[model samples]
Target chain A: MDYGEADRILTLLTREMGRISARAPGARRSQKRFAGRLDRFALVAVRLSGPPHRLTLLEAELEEPFLGLRDRLESSAAAAYVVEVSAALSPEGEAQPRIFGLVLEALAHLAEADGPPSPDLLRAFELKALDAAGLMPALDACAACGGPLAGEGIGFSPAGGGAVCPDHAAADPAASPLSPADVHHLRALARAPLGEPRADVGRAAHRRQASALRTFLDAQLGRRPRSAAFLEQVMET
Target chain B: MAEADPIRRLIHQLSRLPGVGEKTATRLAFHLLRADRAICLDLARALEEVSAQVGLCGRCANLAAIDPCPTCRDERRTDDTICVVERPQDQWALERAPEYRGRFHVLHGALDPLSGIGPEQLQIASLLHRLAPAAVREVILATNPTVEGEATALYLARLLKPLGVKVTRIAQGVALGSEIEYADQGTLSRALAHRHDFG
Candidate 1:
C-alpha cells in the first residue's frame, strides 16, 4: 500500500519471517534504494532495521521478478489471488517455510504455464496452504463423528472443518451438499502437486468445488479476500 | 469545548491533508493568521469554488468544471488520437509538452487486484464507448511504469485491439539528464530492449 509521501507499506511474505509489513521510505520516488525490486510477485532479498513490528526496509535485491506473470491478464490475476490468500493464511513474525514454498511454487507455475492457468492449480495451492495452516478440511472421514464418510448425502461444512455425512449434515445449516464426484475431485486436488493438471471435470463440478473452497476460506479468514472479487471479474472477462 | 474553538478546528482540518501532521498544521494555521486578509479570503473563495464546481468530465472522466471539459470541446485538438492515462495528474504532465494536440481519457486508477480494483472499478467502459465512433485512429496507453500500470495497459490493449483501432503504449527508458551508470537495472534493461538507431 502507498503510504505518506513517497513511502510504501509493503506486505512481504518472507520464507524466514512469514508475513511482515515494513515501511519502505522513499520507495515510490527513489529507485536507488529499492532498485525497482519491490513489485508484486517479485521475490527479493531485503535488508531491514528498527524493531520487529516496525521494521524499516533499508534495501532490497530482486531475486525472481516473475516477469512472465505479466504477459497475460489471467496469469496476473491468478498470481494476485494466490499472493493475497497466502499472505492471509500466514501468521506474522513466524517462520512459514511450507506456506512460503507453496506460494513461490504457485507463482513459478503460473509464470511458466503455457496457456491460461488451470483452475486446479489455484485449488491445489489453497489446499496446501490450508494444510500448512493446520486448517485443511477433513476429507477421509466425517468431521463431526470421525466416522467413515458415506457415499451418498455427503456435505462439506466450513464450520465443522470437513466432510460431513448425512447424519451430521442436518445439524449444520451452513453445510453445502457435496457430491461424491466433487469430493473425489477435491481429494485429487489436495494430493496433486501445485501446477500439475488434473482430470478435466465438468463446469458444474468446478463451480461446486470453487464455492466450497470460498466458503471455507471466508469462514477461516472472517471475510472473503478482496483479490477474490478481482479474480472473478478478470476471469469473467 | 476544544472542538468548538475555531483555531483548533482549522488545525484539525489542515491535518487531514496528506502528509500534514498536527504540528505542521499548527504552523500553517499561524502562518495564515499572519498573512494578508485578502490572501486568506482568496484562498477560502478558491476552495469553495473548487468544491462546488469541480467534477469528473462525463466523456473522458477527467476532473474538470465542465461536462465534456475544455479539452474535449476544443476544436484545435485532433479527433484521430486519444491519450489514456491513469490519473488526471498524468494527463496534466503530458499536457506540459505542447507537441501532442489530442484528446485525453483518464481511468482514474490503474488495475490493482490486491486492492480490489478491477476493470469494472475503472472508467474502461466509457473509453470503449468513445472508441466506437470510429473517429479515433489510435489510443496511447500512458499508464505509469509500475506493475499494476503495466497490467492495466496490457488489459486495455487486449480489449482495444479487436476493435480495429490501433493501440500503443508509451515508451519506457532512462529519464533525460539521468546518468546511465546511476540508472536502475529495470530501467537499463528496458532501455536496452527498446533501443533504436540513433539519428
Candidate 2:
C-alpha cells in the first residue's frame, strides 16, 4: 500500500461506486502528499461529496496505486484490466468500500514486481472480485461431503464453484474437472492478499486456475470481455 | 429489498450468468415467471443433460460425449500417421486442413513441465500405444511455435524415437506473404532443411 515517488491525481473507477472524481488539491505541489501520492496501480484515499450519481473529490492522499507499473507495458495492461473490470462492474453510486480496497491491493501487487510476474496477481484479483461480489467458491470442505479436501488428485467444477467432493460431484458430466493441487492453488490465491502473495507457484496450476476462472466468468458475465481475449492474445504472442 | 432476501438472491444468480446483466436478469426472471412452466423446465433439463452426459475423452483426454471419443473410435483412420497436437481445438484446426487424412492422436496438451504438466500426465501413454503397430510410418508433431509447444514436441520426439518408428516434427514455414530475402536466419534455415524433393 505504498505509492512512493509520485503525487498526482487520478479519477479512478471503483467497482463498488461509480466514476468518482477526487483531487489532491496541491497534492503534486507538496512533498508530503506527493510521497504517498496517486500513480497508476497505487491505491489512494479521497474525500468527496455528491448525489447518488456524481462523485466529487474534496481532499486526496495516495495510499498505493501500484507505482511499480509506472514504466512497464505488460503490467500496465494488467493494471488497466483490473481497473477496467472494476469500472465496469461497479454500480453507479453505492458504497462498495471493500471493492475499492480490494482493487487497490490487486493493482499494487501486479505493479510491485519489475518483470512479468506470474499471472497470480490477475487470478487473485479475479477471485477477489468474485468474493467481493459474493461469488467466492467453497474449496475447503468437500462441496458435497463436508469432509476435508486432501489427497493427490482433486477435481474442479467451475459451475459448481469449487472442487466437487466424491459425494457431491457435479451432476453435469461436462463439468470442467480440476486437479486437487489446482483447487489448492486457487484457494491460496483466493485467500492471499493482493500484494506479493504466493503467485509464482507453477504454470500448469496457473493455467488451470485461469481457465477455470475464465469459464466461471463466461458463465457469469454471459460472455468474455474483449479485454480477457486481449490478454490471452498478448500472452500467446 | 433487504440484503438477505431470497428474491434478491435470485436476481444475483441471474446477473451472474453470461450475457445477463442486472437489468436483463431481472427481465428474464420475470419472463420465466409469466412463461409456460414447461419452457423453464426444458431449459433446466438441457442444463442437466450437458453436465451429466459430456466428459473428457479417456484416450486423447479431449471433451466428448463418449469415453474413447469419436476420433479414436473410427477404425478407418490410418493408424500409421498419427498427427500429434496440443489441445482438442488444435485437432479441429488440423481437421480443417483436410490434406492430412491420417488419424490424429491428441496429446490433450503439450508438455509444459514448468506448470507441472509432465509427459506422464498428458495422453502420452495412449500415443505410445498408437505407435506399437508396425504399419505406422511417421509421427508428425504439430505443436505451436511457442516455447512450451516446442518443449512438448522435443519431449515427444525423444520418447517416440526409441520406439523405432520414424519420428518427424512439422516445420513452420515463413508466411506466404514473406519473401526469402526478408526471412530471418531461423526461418531460412528451417526452409532449407525442409525443402521439398523436386523431380
TM-score of each: 0.91, 0.42
Which 10-residue window in model 2 chain A sums to the lowest lDDT?
Answer: A1-10
DockQ of prediction 2:
0.01
lDDT of 2 by residue, A1-237 (tens): 111222233466655455555444445445433433343444555666766344444555644434345334355456556765665556555556667777766666666666754677777788787777676767787665566666644555566666676545546453455677777777787887765456366777678778877777566656555456535643543
Displacement of residue B9 (Cα, Å) in model 1 is 2.9
Q: Which segments of candidate 1 are over 4 A away from where they belong?
A: A29-31, A170-172, B188-199
Looking at chain B only, the TM-scores across the models are: 0.96, 0.67
Deviation in angstroms for B165 in model 2? 44
Q: Give the lDDT of residue A187 in candidate 2.
A: 79
lDDT of 2 by residue, B34-74 (tens): 89999989987987897898887765666778888898788
